[model samples]
Target: MRRTFKWGFIGVMVLIVGLFLDYTLPQHDVVRITDTYNRVTPLGSLNRLFYASPDAGTKPGTAAPDIRFIAAVRPNGKVIVYRNEDTGWIWPPFFKFNSSNLQAEASAMKSTADAPRWVMVTNYGWRIPFLSTYPNAIGIRAVSGPDVKVFPWLNIFILVVLALIVVFFWRMWVRFRERTLDPLIAGGQERWDRTEARAENAAADVKSWWRRIIRRGR
Candidate 1:
C-alpha cells in the first residue's frame, strides 16, 4: 500500500512537471498592437525599405505610381505616416509614432476605396518593425540599425527546467531502489531457515541410531 501510494504520487508529480515544462518552455511571437491610427504613410521607399518581394511596389491609392505609402493601425487610436521618399517628399528625421496610431491609419485606409488598399502588414502574424535594418527603422519597437537582439534567456530557462525535471525523476528512482528493494534482497532469511532445518534432521538421525545399538547390545 505504501509503495502504491508513493508511485501514484510520483506519477502525479511527473505529470504536473511535464505540463509546466510544456507550457512555460515554448516561445511564440505574441502580436499586440498598441495603438490605432487614421492611416500609415511610408517615408521614402519605406515599403522597399521595410517590406520586400510581394509587399514592395504598390502604394495605397496609387497604381503604377513611382512611389507608395505604407502605415499600420494600432489597437488604440493613433496614426503612423509612412510617406514614399521617391515621391519627392522629405519627412522629418524624428517623429512620435505609436502602435495605436498605425492601427487606426490601417483601418481608415481599408475602409476607403483606394487603388492599393491599406491593410495590416504582418509576417507570420507578428507585428514587425518597419525596417529590416536600423537608422531608418520606422515601427515602434524597431531599432534604427541592424543590431536588434534576440533574447537567449528564454532558451536558457527551458534548458534549466528540463535539467531539473530529469534530476528529480532520477533521484526518486534511486531512493526507491536503495531504500526498499536492496535490503529485501540482501537480508537472507530464506537461507538461514534452510540451514536450521538441516541441523535438526541430522541430530534426530544420530540419536535414533544410538538407541538401536543400545537395544541390540541389551
Candidate 2:
C-alpha cells in the first residue's frame, strides 16, 4: 500500500511537470500555410486555462471573443490549426502584442495544395479538439521545404538552467537539515534520556527511604 502511494505521488508530479513544459516550451511544426483568419471563439471553463487571458484579444466583456487563427496542412496531409494571440506580459512571458501582424504574415505565406510552400510555425500549447483549444502560434517563417532540421538550443539551455537551480536548492536543504536540524534532534533525545534516568533514580531512592522507615517502626 505504501509503495503504491509513493508511486502514485511521483506519477502525479511527473504529469504536472510534463503538462507545464508542454504548455510553456515552444514547438516547431513544418507545414503548408493554407489560410489565416479571425473568428469569435467561445471560451469555456474546461479550456480557459489553455487560451490567453480573458482581456487579451477578447470581446471586451463577453464570454466569446475574436481570435486570429492559422490553418495549415502538415506534410503527411494532416490539418493543424493554431491560435494567434498576445501573451500579455505574464506567465510564460512571451509578451506578444502583435497578433494582427502575425495574422498578416500567415496570410501572406498562404499556399496551395499542388505546389506547397513549406513554412515553420513556432508555437506553444496543445490542440485538444474536445475542449476546442489549439496551439498558440507566436512566430512563423518560410522554410526551404518540409524536411528541415531545427535544433532546439534554447529549450536545451532552459532545461539545463532549471536542473541546476533544482540541484542547488536540494543540496542546500540537505546540508541545512544535517548541520542544524539533525543536531537539535539529537540534543533533544539526549535531554529526554537524562530526564528518564533522573526519574528512575528518584523512585528508587523513595523506595529505599520507605523501607528504612518500615524497619524502624517494626
Candidate 3:
C-alpha cells in the first residue's frame, strides 16, 4: 500500500510537471498561414483561465469581447489554430503586446496551396476544443521551406537552469536534515534505547535476587 501510494504520488507529480511544461514552453510549428481574424470569445468557468486575464491587454472580461486568431495548415494536412494576445508582464512572462502586428503579418503571409510559403510560428499553451482553448502565438518568422529545422535553445536553457535549481535546493534539504533534524532524532532514539536496556537489566537483577531467596528458603 505504501509503495502504491508513493508511485501514485510520483505519477501525479510527473503529470503536473508535463502539463506545466506543455503550457509554458514555446513550441514551433511550420505551416502555411490560411487566415487571420477576430471573434468575441465567451469565457466559461472551465476555459476562462486559459484565456488572457483582463487588464493584461483586453478589456475587463469574463467573456473576452475581442480575441484575435490565426489559422494555418501543416504540410501533413493538419489544421492548427493559434490565438494572439498580450501576456502583459504576468504569468509565463512572455510580455507579448503586439497581437495586432502579428495578425497583420499573418494576414500578409497567407499563401496558396500550390505556392505555399511555410512560416515557423512560435507559440505556447494548448488547444483544447472541448474547453475552447488555443495556443497563444508569440512570434512568427519566415523559414526557407516547410522542412526547415527549428531548434529549441530557449527551452533547453530554461530546463537546464531549472534542473540545477532543483538539485541545489534538494541538496540543501538533505544537508539540513543530516546536520540538524537527523542528529536530534538520533539522540532521542539513543536515549530511549539506553533507558530500555537499563530497565531490562534491573528487572533481571530483581528476578535473580528473588530466585536466590526462594532457593535459600527451599
Model 1: how far is 23 from its true place, Å? 4.4
TM-score-wise, the better of 1 and 3 is 3
Q: Specify the highest-TM-score model's number.
A: 3
Tens digit per residue, CA lDDT, model 1, 1-218 = 99999999999998997755543242322122222323233445543433221222334554332323344333333443342222112222123233344434434544322223223332211123544221121233332222334465765876788799889999999999899877776665666778788889999999999999999999
Candidate 2 lDDT over residue span 98-157, tens digit each: 888889999999999988999999999999899999999999899999899699998898
Clashes in model 3: which pairs?
Answer: none
Rate residue 69 of model 1 by lDDT: 39
Cα RMSD of all models vs. native, in order, equals: 19.7, 3.5, 3.3
Local error of candidate 1 at residue 187 (angstroms): 5.3
lDDT of 2 at 145: 94
By TM-score, how accurate is candidate 2? 0.84
- Model 2 regions more than 4 Å off: 1-8, 54-60, 192-218
Which lDDT value does model 2 have at 79?
Answer: 99
